[model samples]
Target: MIISILVLEGPYNHEASDSAYNFIQAALAKGHAIRGIFFYDDGVYNVTRLMDPPQDDRHISRRWSELGATGIDMVVCIAAAKRRGITNEVLAPNIRISGLGQLASMIHESDRIVTFGD
Candidate 1:
């Protein structure tokens, strides 16, 4: 099935982001296609390229990038990202800065839309 994912929380501070990541990975492993991942609210932090967590911790941004490398679009809500100080200049490779319209389009095009976080 073709799927789209929405993430609404920042990494580490909550489990939502990690859960979303795990779910996406599992879906991909099962040979499902991901239409994209939309980062909304605090989830925009997942696309920030400058993130540097302790070595012991999973690098959340990198994890997203790896998924992006496989051709899944990683979209960050421009308004939400700007409110949190994430600019296009610092976006990770394969991450795109876009408006909510992109999210809407993804939802319209995907076979299923799954959201993680409150």
Candidate 2:
């Protein structure tokens, strides 16, 4: 199955981000293909490379980068990113900034669209 994920919350503020991450990982492990991950609202924070969590904590942004390394497209809504002060200079290497049109395209192309949080 081809899956696309939309995340609506920030990384540490809620479990939604972690849940989405685990879901993607498990889905990939099961040989499912991920169409993409589109970040909106507070979820745009996931693409920021400036996140420096506690040493023992999981670096969510890094995990996203790693996932992108495996060829899964990762996108952050441009409006959302700008509203949250996430700029291209601070964006993760594999994360791209785009408009809602890209999200629409992902939804149209995927077999399933899974949304996390509000």
- What CA root-mean-square deviation does each model show from the true structure? 0.9, 0.8
lDDT scores of the candidates, listed in order: 0.92, 0.93
The TM-score leader among the candidates is 2
TM-score per model over all chains: 0.96, 0.97
Off by over 4 Å in 1: none
Evaluated at residue 34, the lDDT of candidate 1 is 96
Clashing pairs in 2: none
What value does the lDDT take at residue 42 in candidate 2? Answer: 96
lDDT (Cα) of model 2: 0.93
Instruction: State the lDDT of candidate 2 residue by residue for 1-85, as single tens digits.
Output: 9999999999999999999999998998999999999999999988789999999999999999999888889999999999989
lDDT of 1 by residue, 1-118 (tens): 9999999999888899999999998998999999999999999988788989999989999999988998889999999998999998888888889999999999999999999987
Clashes of 1: 0
